[model samples]
Target: MVVGSDGFWRLLYPIHHAETIRQAAEKNNLDPLLIASIIRVESKFRAENVSKVGAVGLMQLMPETADWIAKESDIPYRGTVDLSDPETNIHMGSWYITSLIKQFKGNRAAAIAAYNAGPGRVSRWINEGVWDGTFETSEKIPVGETRHYIQRVFFSYEKYQQLYPNF
Candidate 1:
């Protein structure tokens, strides 16, 4: 298949909150492209986006999850955190993904899957031999949404790399 021009792809996969993404990723020792990919797949860079399940902001993080992340990551929180803020959401999301990567032993597929399906479920799948937590075996993951979510993040990540090589 012939891919679209870089300009066209850039138009479709625009990166918003670059500085915030960079800061969050760097602080968490993560690739900014990965964060951008997650944001694209999660909320398409829309800060006000909210999922049907109460996930909010560009990263579509749930309030409870954000609160947990803040506590774990030592981010400032006093019960009411505005997840709609790009900086806060990206930082928390980055930290959470970084933790997930560590929890899954750097298995990005599993980490990304856990980001969508929750760590407990992913761990259960791994422990039960339901899935091996590798990108190659992502198809074996029981949750279709998580499998598709990983695929989308990967696609967006590649496009971001291609369009913004220097980023």
Candidate 2:
């Protein structure tokens, strides 16, 4: 879905439980605003939104990743369509993001990139030590799309904080 500059909902998106998203993020020690912002950037909060690449739902989870998360988290195996549910999506996604953060030693940019680009890309960045302000280590961020994804999410993080000051 195409989101405008303002980031308002032009069409109804299925973010039914802001509190659930918040709780999952907090439980994982992630900034709730950051999670919310990523959802905004990733899928424009459109649950059931599928990417051309087959990432599904509000967080646009890939099928393999969704299966992995479900198995790892002991969440019941639902078909990919259940990803549209804010509560389930955020629960699994928040856990997965927390996993990435640990793997990257709390590097927000690296974890975020991994979330977008995949673990292999983030690992290369870690090894090469090439990075930008948007990245702490940039050696292996070869994919331009992942780079831009990181930038957009970081920008959205700030805006999310402003939109909901308490979050």
Candidate 3:
């Protein structure tokens, strides 16, 4: 298959947090590649990236979500700036993703789509029953930006799988 361009994943991921995220994902029995993909999709791998929607840091964690993650993971975090650290964000973010997996019954694709769009929206789609799992696999995502993001993360997942198949 003649691949297109390298894709929208050119931004630099923090080398420091790579190890941390790997460890956290391993501990959670989650795929570090998927976590990496989430970071890429969530914040384009910037440690201090902040979204206009009030999501902050590498994981693009919203304030409420960050607090929930902190509580659920029992991680010590004070202000929102702590999330600006790539390591902390990835730590919590990967755990949160794993939690969502449990919530969604290992449906990583649906959980990812919900993370990008929102549980309610995804739930609506799911209840509509017109969407099979393929609808969650990037190409069929409803929202335009989320559609691109889902595709990008899956592409990143493919790259990470090739790079670290054992993980």
- Number of the predicted model whose lDDT against the real structure is largest: 1
lDDT of 3 by residue, 1-167 (tens): 23343332323332236688779888889878788778876776778788988999988988898888887887778879898987778888888788877777888777777788776787677678634445344565667876776777787787767555665
Candidate 2 residue-wise lDDT at 82: 77
**Candidates ranked, most accurate by TM-score first:** 1, 3, 2
Q: What is the C-alpha RMSD of each candidate to the true structure, in Å?
A: 2.2, 4.4, 4.0
Total clashes for model 3: 0
In model 1, the Cα lDDT at residue 164 comes to 93
Question: What TM-score number comes out for model 3?
Answer: 0.83
Candidate 1 deviant stretches above 4 angstroms? 1-3, 79-81
How far is 47's C-alpha from truth in model 3 (Å)? Answer: 0.4
lDDT of 1 by residue, 45-125 (tens): 999998899999888888899888877887665543478878888888999999999998989999999999999999999
Residue 75, model 3: Cα distance from true site in angstroms: 1.4
Deviation of model 2 at 3, angstroms: 17
Model 2: what TM-score? Answer: 0.82
